[model samples]
Target: MVEFDLVAPRSADEAFAALRAAAPDGAAVLAGGTDLLPDVDEGRQRPRVVVSLRHLPWRTLDWAGPSLTIGSTLPLRALEQDPDLVRRFPGLAEAIRDVGSVALRHRATLGGNVVRAAPTSDLVPVLLALDAEVEIVGPRGTRRLPVDRFVRASRRVDLGPEELVRAVWFPEARPSAYRWQRVRPANDISQVAVAAACSPADRRWRIAVGGVAPRPVRIPSAAEALGAGAPTAAAVARAARAAADAVAFPTDRRASADYRRHLVATLVERVVDAVVRAEGFPR
Candidate 1:
């Protein structure tokens, strides 16, 4: 392991200062360290300093009417266990459960996932489907960006040197579902994943997929194919087809490009159908 200084800031201001101070040499912000530590161990990252957010007061989950704000440091298990999360954002809840195992979920955090911006992240596709926004705090001030804009590419994000993710904001509750095809049933990465949601306010559908290169993304064509409200079986099939053709799937050790394309098509239909049925939409 590379030698690095570790600092746990008690306040947001101090955290910012610690980051700014360590900027010249390279610094890493640690939430739960589930991702960061592994990267460090593998020599993927060698920061001069590791700023820990453990002492910060950011482990929060709040609901205001239809909106939800999740503190960046909050554990994935906390989200999975939230009584209303499964009902209001079923897709998000399902993604949380899919992260790893119960033990890993206890330490894995939403902010870390977003910050790492892994191409195969199970949460990102659902966040895209939900139109989630990332709340960032830095030396300048706090700012927010849509998750779509926040995540730029694989293992990359739009975070500034001194910035840290404060929370993720979901503007409204939606009827949604998440599904994935993995090599193993438990503690394995997904070969392909799909998240589908129907906005309650606009009655429009949204579809997002993972396991693509660069980043997870919303498939507008697929979503449009679903039309408004409950989609017919034919429409769902069309959407699935559209999704299957949407992204350029990469052939990796886990699966072939053709297999991923097939999985996306199949999972898209299942997720959309799940949202429609589970949410009691008129079929």
Candidate 2:
């Protein structure tokens, strides 16, 4: 392993200065270090410096009124059991639960997942379904981008070299639903995952699928199928199948593209049934 310096800044501005200094040299951001650390241990993320974002004032700077801002260091486990989140946005909680084992969740942060931009990331589908946005900061300033557009590639994001993720903002507490099913070994990528949700407050709905594509795929038509009116079991099943059919999934070791499509459809339908029913939808 090559030697590297670890820098911890007191604030975002300081962090950006450190990043700028390391830009010509090569430095990487460190949150909970769930994904990057693994690669580093396996000889992948070689950098001259590893900036410990731990020291920055993530709690204060991250909070934005109305829209909830989450720091990059906040644990996934924290999200899984968040009370306000469970009551206000359970769909995201469901997706967070499926991220990994309890231990991994304790160390994995939402910002890391968004910045990492893995196509099959568990949070992507749920966040996209909820229309979450990311706050990116660097030498310039902060800018917000839709989560869906932020994860446009399989393994790359839109962040520049000097950029460091500041926070993720949830503009509204949209009611939604999610389900992820996998037929793979432990710690392996998902075979098929489904997430769906609707904001009863505004009649906005979202249903996104993952595990079968480079990134989470959305089924707007399915969500549109659900107006303020909730559907029955049969209708839910049909919507699920229709959603699976809508996306052009890619094949992977976890499952065949054909099987994944079926999983996406069925799981989306099942989760929709669960969410709508859980929230007291009319039969």
Candidate 3:
């Protein structure tokens, strides 16, 4: 790995200034560093300067009316163990539980995972299904965007060179479920993952999938079908088939395209069924 300067900023302003000073060679923002450090060690990223957000003031969780705002630097382990978060956003908690091991989760930040934009990121699909929004601070000031659009493609995001993720916001929570297909129960990386959220009262639901494409995507056809009415086994099967057909799976070391397609169908059905049961869908 190349030698680079590491700057630990005590505040957001200092972090922003450091990033500006390091341009256009650019600086990598270090929060948790679970993903960035590995790439840096592998010589895949050679930033001239590394800005650490660990000392910054972005590591708190708060409630904004009906929404929950999670500081970007808040550790995944905190989210996993927060009783309020677990009760309100069970699906998100479940996804975070699947991220690496307990030790890794202790050092991984939710923002870091979203910014990494990897197809296999455990939290991305669940966040998308929950309609989460990301708050970012840059040279221009603060801005917010839907989580689904924040990640543009594999290992790519909408954040500007000097932008730093401040926090993530989730609207009112609803009944939700998540299921992932992995090679083993101990493996954190998923071959296919599905997240579903439902509002049985309104017959509205959302579904998103990851690890089957360049980026996590909402399965609109399946969501539409499930949201139209009660999701019976037949209806769930139909939605799963639609989701399988809609995803563009690519062959990867963990699994083949065909295998991923099958997993997507199966997991979609499983997650939808789980959510339906949790929501007590009418018989």
Candidate 4:
């Protein structure tokens, strides 16, 4: 059996110190442990130490006017239950519901998902469409990066060894929708997911796709095809096709490249249409 030391720091400074001390030997950050625990049990990861963020004061959700901030350690279930969260960011709410079962979501966290940087993550695509930013705190101090820049690829992030994700920030609320195709709806991973949103401030649309290799990315060309608010059917089709052709889908055990391409196109169209209707755009 593999054995390792576990530490729960009471403060951010202590957390960083613990991480720094354990870095040479290898250390893994434990948030919700929804993913980390699985990796550890499956022998996919073997660290000398595991640093838990349980004692940190990061479980929070705050809204300032139109902007919102989600504390890193906050449980996904808590976020999903907030009525304002559902009303203000429906796509995000939909993605959160797709994460795992209720019991799993009770322990799963948004920060953990972002840090995991899984290409199949349901939340990241919505975050991309919402133009979210990640806040990080490290030995060098705190800094923020756009979600697009923060998530580099599958199981990879731009976080430093001694850094902790503090929170995720959204610039403003948006009318959005998220849709995905999966083997099972309850606790299975997505084969392909699409997130669509329109900025109330600018009336410009944002589109992003998940389940692609490397990472989930915002498709600027797809958004361009959408043009401004309440795109006509032709524009929506163009955007969907653009999204379908933009990404290089991976042929893995779960799905084929062609199947994913088709899913992306279909889901993109559905999500965009949903967002438009949700916003009460004229038919």
Candidate 5:
């Protein structure tokens, strides 16, 4: 690993100042360091300075009115095991559970996962399906963006160089399901992943897909079809096919473009089926 200076700020103010004063050579924020550390060790990243956010105080999960607010530095394992959180957002819980392994989850933060902006991130699609929003703080101030829009592309996000992700807020809980396909059964990045959520109050279905595009994508067409009327197996299949066709998967070492497309359709079908059944809607 390249030699670098580490700055640990005890508070958000200190962290902000450190970010503003970051050297011209460049600086990278460190949350759990589950991803950043690996890149540094692999020589893929060699920032002159690393700002560690682990010392910041925002590491608790709470309910703010009707919405669920998750601290940016909270461990993924915390969310995966929280009974209340699991009951409120089963899809999100499942996604977090599938991220890496028990040991990794203990060190991985939701904010880091979102900010890393990996196309294969397990939580991105599920958060998009839930219409989650992220709170960002920078030299300017705080601003919010939908989870779907936060990630611009692979390893890219909307955050500025001096910005820090504060927390993620979910409007409310809804019936949802998440599924992913991987090359192996052990802890591995997903080749294709799909998440589906149904808002019975509005009779709307939301769908998001990952690992088949440059970034996670929401499938409005598929959501429309499955939510148009009473969901049926035939309708779900048609919608899944449409979604599969919509994504242009790039050929990667883990899977071919054609195989990724196939996985998209199959996973979408499974997610829709699971969501519909869980919502007590006939199919």
Candidate 6:
């Protein structure tokens, strides 16, 4: 592993300044370090200076009217068991539960996960499904970006040199449900992952698929197929097809593209069925 200097800032301003000092040359901001450590050790990433944000002031969760402001430093474990969060956004809570092991969850922060932007991130699909917004602090000032636009294929964002993920604000959903499934390859990462969410208030739903492409992605065409009017076997199949076609799955050691595509359809169906049952409704 490469050796680098570590800096811990007590406040956001100090952190921003430290980042600015190192920004022109590309500095890395460290959070819980769960995602960064592996890459650095494996030679996928190297940094001259690692600015640790764990001691910064971005660790509190606050309420904002119909929305809840989740701090960037808040751990996934806290998200998993927060009663208010569970009741208001069950889909998010469920997503948090599936992030990793209990110990990992206790130290994995939301900001870190989103910033990592891995294709298989457990929370990405659910956050995108809810049409959430991202909070970022950059040199220009803090700005809010939509969760969808925040996602890019290169696992990079528009964040400026002095920027860091500050928080995420999402409105309290009005009764929602979500479904998730993962096909774990025997000796590798997941072959495929499927997730879906439904909001009864608008009678609208979203379906997101991960682990089949370069990024955890949203399939607009397939989501449209799963309309709010009524559920049927035919509708399910059509939606599944769109969802599969929307992705450009590739053949990898985990699974062949064909296998992943087939599983995507099956998982989509399974999730849709589970969600319907969860809502005390029929397909």
Candidate 3 segments whose C-alpha is farther than 4 A from its true place = 200-202, 279-283
Model 6 spans > 4 angstroms off: 174-188, 278-283
For residues 184-226, what per-residue lDDT tens digits would candidate 6 score against the true structure?
A: 3221245676666666556666787777567777787777898
Q: Once model 6 is optimally superposed onto the true structure by TM-score, how far is the C-alpha of residue 138 displaced, in angstroms?
A: 1.8
TM-score of each: 0.98, 0.90, 0.95, 0.97, 0.95, 0.89
Q: Which tens-of-lDDT digit does each residue in 1-283 have in candidate 1?
A: 5788999999999998999999865899899898899889899999999999999999999999999999999999999999898888888998999998999989999999999998989999999999999999998999999999999999989999989999999999898999999989778888999998899888899899998997999999999999999888999999999999988999999999999999999999899988997664434
Please report, in order, the local distance difference test score of every candidate based on alpha carbons: 0.92, 0.76, 0.85, 0.92, 0.86, 0.76
Candidate 4 lDDT over 161-192, as tens digits, reads: 89989999999999999999999998998999
Shift of residue 86 alpha carbon in model 1, Å: 1.3
**Model 5 TM-score on a 0 to 1 scale:** 0.95
Clashing pairs in 4: none
* Poorly placed runs, candidate 5 (over 4 Å): 23-25, 228-230, 279-283
Model 1 residue runs over 4 Å out of place are 280-283
lDDT string for model 3 (77-169, tens) is: 999999888776778988999988889889999999999888788889999888899999987899999998899988889998789999999
Judge candidate 1 at residue 78 and give its lDDT. 91
Give, for candidate 1, the lowest lDDT window spanning 10 residues. 274-283
